[model samples]
Target: MSDSILDRANKGILGLKPYEPGKPIEETQKELGIQNIIKLASNENPLGISPKALNVISTQKDLNRYPDGNATNFKQKVSEEEGIKTSMITVGNGSNDLIEFVSKCFLSEGDNAIYSQHGFAIYPLAIKSTGASAIKAKAKNWEHDLSLMKELIDKNTKVIFLASPNNPTGTVLESKKIEKFLEDIPSNVAVFVDQAYFEYLEEEKHKVSFNLVENYKNLIISRSFSKAHGLAALRLGYAVSSEEIAEFLNRVRQPFNTNSLALAAGIKAIEDKDHISSSIEINKSGLKKAEEAFNSLGFEYIDSYGNFISFDSQQDSDLSFDFFLKKGIILRSLKVYEMPNHLRVSIGLEEEMNAFIETLHDYKKALDAG
Candidate 1:
């Protein structure tokens, strides 16, 4: 037999499951020979992008120059917007980059990280890539069981990953419970609160993650521009922590991890408060419409704080997902999150939401006929 080049990978790497992204619109359309497809699979902004952001990116004159290594201007802008210090932030290409950086910085082969069952998939993936072990606490009511997480933490546990308004389940951890949990955990173990969907929440509804960051040295809050900011295509995200932690993360971070155009877009996106408000308003309306449709269909859904909702599917979610695809609509099947009978749908524009609901109704009719 010929010598194999693939045999050189680490044993753990061979068994890892590659992240399965939602099917791209172009690829799905090509495969099915259909046009006019509605995509509610990926949690992208249905309003597209801010006009001010597009204008700023189009007039870029410094394509050849390297970006600010420290992301000084971006940090300043974020600090101004969030009432947090520039020293408290570390920018990333996306939040995924920050997650990987945390995994590399804090975890070794014998170390462990705790996350909940049905949590964000990246937690386990990031932990595993560092040759560390993952401990999953069983979810309660499809949400993180903080008590179980506390029970699982040992001396070797270096980090814990929790997402408020968690993906696939659309569950939000209450602020008081999280505060209590943070107080209970030892000071050494870092706790990361992923707030990718923060903007979608109302003022009263937003989790108090950033508020607790200073009180606990081990706390980190990760935010992203991919959702309500309408900058998902630009791949901009950031984390807020103590200055010491930020300094250490910066040491491990790659130079120029974020591109110039993306930086320009993010700066412009943040400055355009009108665009941001409009996006949230649109999401609120879309959420109402989606919830109404789910009720009309007699489907139970998690009342979500984010811009997406996960609902119980009448049939196997994999089959229901296939049905949606055939109808030129796309929804996320939650089999990867261990919910085989549920599908998550991102809040889209009014017309897009109507199309998704109509397509789903058609699937039900077809099932009845059969």
Candidate 2:
């Protein structure tokens, strides 16, 4: 028999574009012969993992034992924290996993999914993996244009993915706007609100609709421990939805998809109130620093509510990326989201942010000279 696996693979899988992650620090260091390169590309928490999660991992002793398939205890902890029933939650390898599982369970070749132009790249990837048609709605000033999305939703629409404080653009959909959109959408179409960066929102400004599980039967709220909780390495996240929807996701998800360490880390991370607060504070400080830096550089950026800001260098982003690479700094060029002139940079610690600003100044000068 021929060993050509590509030929045997499903058509949709074959057509899928592999996700391109942010470049690793080691890889950049090796390539450029630079030391201590700063990576602000992948919206990672600069404070690192919570001390509680780290302590849990330090004491974890069951590497040989299989994780709980149902994740009952962890679900219970999440239930207590969120004031929702365990049945309303489905844990994920990462929030990205839940997005993929939801797409698999609800979408098909005949169905369509709607998303904003510069939303997270994972939504389109997930929909396409299920052989579902993805409808790209135009953004209104880098934010989700719900009106355009609403108009695009037809009888065949099965899912609509909205990224609050959207990636690449860092524009959030207002609570009233989302509530209005949810009220207008058909009952059968599932609404997945990707709140991967949810914890970074200030308490007064946080407007997540997690309780919509009771009100909007078809709504799903996806969250992650990766961002504010700083558990990115553990790959722990979860979804909150109606019991029926949760059951469908559980059916499609693999048993023991979450390992024991990740579960422990997630539980501890959730309980670490101080860590969450500090992380948010640091992000707020970083945001202010970044805004001032942008103003000093005379670069225009979208006023961001998330831990990252998307700005245009008024030159090709690819050129800007290359220029920044040589300066031992990394930023995401959003050509993948079709914003070729823009770059999205994650907020970092004060020193790191200052270093990045200094690098930007040096690069700007070099550009002028060239």
The sequence of per-residue lDDT tens digits that candidate 2 reaches over residues 1-370 is 7858878766566777898999899999999999979899988999999888899988989789999988888999999988999999999998999999899999988889999998899998999888888899999888899989999999999999999878978888776678788899898999999898887765544577677679899899999988998988888899999999999999999998999999998888889999989989999999998899889888899988788998887789999998888888899899999998888889999998999888878877876787
Please provide, for model 1 over 1-370, each residue's C-alpha lDDT reduced to its tens digit, 9 standing for 90 to 100: 5757667655445667999988899998999999988899889899888999999899988788998888888888999888999999999988888888788889878899999999989999989878899889999998899999999999999999999878878788877888888899998999988889888767564566565778988988898889988988899999999988888888889999998888889999998889989889888988888889889878888888888889888778999899989988889999989888899999999899888888868876876777
Candidate 2 stretches greater than 4 Å from native: 1-8, 203-206
What total of clashing residue pairs does each candidate reach? 0, 0
* Residue 220 alpha-carbon offset, candidate 2, angstroms: 0.3
Q: Name the runs in model 1 displaced over 4 angstroms.
A: 1-7, 203-205
How close is every model to the real structure, measured as TM-score?
Answer: 0.96, 0.96
TM-score of 2: 0.96
- Model 1 residue 122 CA deviation (Å) reads 0.9
Instruction: Please give the lDDT score at residue 13 for candidate 2.
Output: 69
